[model samples]
Target: MSEPPVSYKRHRFPPQIIAHAVWLYFRFPLSLRLVEKLLLERGIVVSYETVRVWAHKFGPDYVRCLRRKKPSRQDIWHLDEVVVTINSEKRYLWRAVDQDGYVLDEIVQIRRDTRAAKRLLERLLCKQGCPPKRMITDKLGSYGAARRKIMPKVEHCQHKGLNNRAENSHVPIRKRERAMQGFRSWSGLQRFVETFPAVRNHVVPPHSHRSAFATHLHRLAAMAEWKSVTLTAA
Candidate 1:
């Protein structure tokens, strides 16, 4: 007996619009309503609700695709935490980034204790699967404990002033938070942070390189190839 055929319904907006909407959502800290207004100004008539739906569906998918295409791995990793107030409660966002300032992973949790830190580290290790040769962090005791548990062989460097790379990397996210009025939920915060890093890595040129039109084109082309390979691999 033959199996029944499957049918897929096409979305109303073209792939371009869907891609554009997802980019806007992460590229800036704008809310869905603001994005819809901006699109209206650009002569694209789409509702804010539709924009929200598009972001929830396609934003992470795009980021995942980009990650798969880029095979470079971080050898040295930096870990840190930042405080974010959501709905009158203070929460901590645990973040890990490579030496080049590319975010590896992030998790927002209610507490910044050893348990939370350990969980975050485990998640990061599991996702990237490449243990850093050197881990840089501030004088946070939890980091010491977490490092010992997950990466016993890796050197853990803790000091007051040495982890500046990780500290400085939070500036972009801080700026983004100011524009969006803070994230409303833990899951939302995680999704946004995870997606933002890939977008930033794609658009921003290496610090040592000169920024020019040609450089911008090259970065974008590299990003396109990265995404293609990643999606195909997945």
Candidate 2:
């Protein structure tokens, strides 16, 4: 006999409660304590510590499920990096998004040099399974250097003003930073950055191009997919 696909084994709280807590934490900039208070208002009693545990345990699992369901990324990629502070130390967040604003990948590193650019490119290549048809990025010399070394065949456009899609994507990070004050550790920041975009992509619709009915349908599909993934308790 094999183990069943659905198992909430040894969990006192049922799947719905656990999943809802994790969702509230990632789906918004809410802290664990804030999430606990929100759940308490809903007549569910769970501690902030418990919410933190659920996030660490179930957040990655939900991201994996969402990534599997996302549509194939568009060929043109927009890449950018911004300096971020962690524990008062400087770090760089490198992000890659498709032309359609789909977050293809993200990573954090201590440097914004050629090495860091290479790390981001390697992740994109490994995840996308090929070089993009064209990549647009700010006029970062490191990006150009890394592109030539790692993906010389792909078309690379280095222009500061042409990467608005990638630039605008940083707004959420700024918002979350204010909401949380600031991150305490690089590891935690990396984990959140890696997983948060998956949740965002699952929720944000391209409203400019979608009709009201089409937007509703898109959200329905997103919620259905969320339930399918998070309904399993970790």
Candidate 3:
């Protein structure tokens, strides 16, 4: 049986309006107020708070509906963790991405230890449904320890120079973090990271590009897919 379309029965605005609002908020580094301003420019009167509510309620639904790349045994996984300061407290955001620069998984935790590394590894294994050909990371002992316990057969390369791809993946999050003026709570940061990466992975051009025409086509397809997933097709 086919899955039912997304329900927007109680929303005051149309699905397209709400989905567009949500997309504007996530697809760019725009704040709620900025998104509201952009919508007002379109002659749509909506408050920033309304945009916030729409993004919170509908962002995950869009992520779930969006298509994801299938896991393959030949893939190379790059794993890394970065510290995020939330509400005067420190936390670690662990992320995994494939060789193609597609974000595979992310998790926020209180520690950056072996246990935390193991949890991230476990999540990736469950989500990807297969181990990659090789794992690369900075000289983080926790990752090495976790790899041995989780998948001893997987090739592990520990070198900062070779882990630039994983390290560079943190740049977008940093930009969003600065724009938001830092996150207020751990849960909120977790939720934002989850939704943000999915939208970015879908819309942005691939890490390695071929031509301007190809890039344009890539974005066009991304926008179409976004509309289809968000149930905002015209």
Q: Judged by TM-score, which candidate is best?
A: 3
Sort by lDDT, best first.
Answer: 3, 2, 1
Q: Which pairs of residues collide in candidate 1?
A: 68-230, 69-230
Model 2 ranges with Cα > 4 A deviation: 1-7, 67-74, 232-234
C-alpha lDDT of all candidate models, in order: 0.75, 0.83, 0.90
Worst 10 residues of 2 by lDDT: 65-74
Per-prediction TM-score, please?
0.84, 0.91, 0.96
Top candidate, metric lDDT: 3
Candidate 2 C-alpha lDDT tens digits along 55-98: 88777877776634333434788999888987668988999988
Q: Can you write out model 1's per-residue Cα lDDT over 1-234, one digit (the tens) per residue?
A: 432221113787666666677777777767788889888898899998898777777766666555332324447788999998888888888888787677777788888888998998789778876777788999989999988887788898998698887888788889878777777777778777777877777666554556588787867786575445333222
By TM-score, highest first, what's the ranking? 3, 2, 1
lDDT of 3 by residue, 133-219 (tens): 999999989999999999999999999999888989999898888877887788888888889999999988768856999999999
Preferred candidate (TM-score higher): 1 or 3: 3
lDDT-better candidate, 1 vs 2? 2
Per-candidate total of colliding backbone pairs: 2, 0, 0
Candidate 1 residues lying further than 4 Å off, grouped into runs, are 1-8, 67-74, 209-214, 222-234
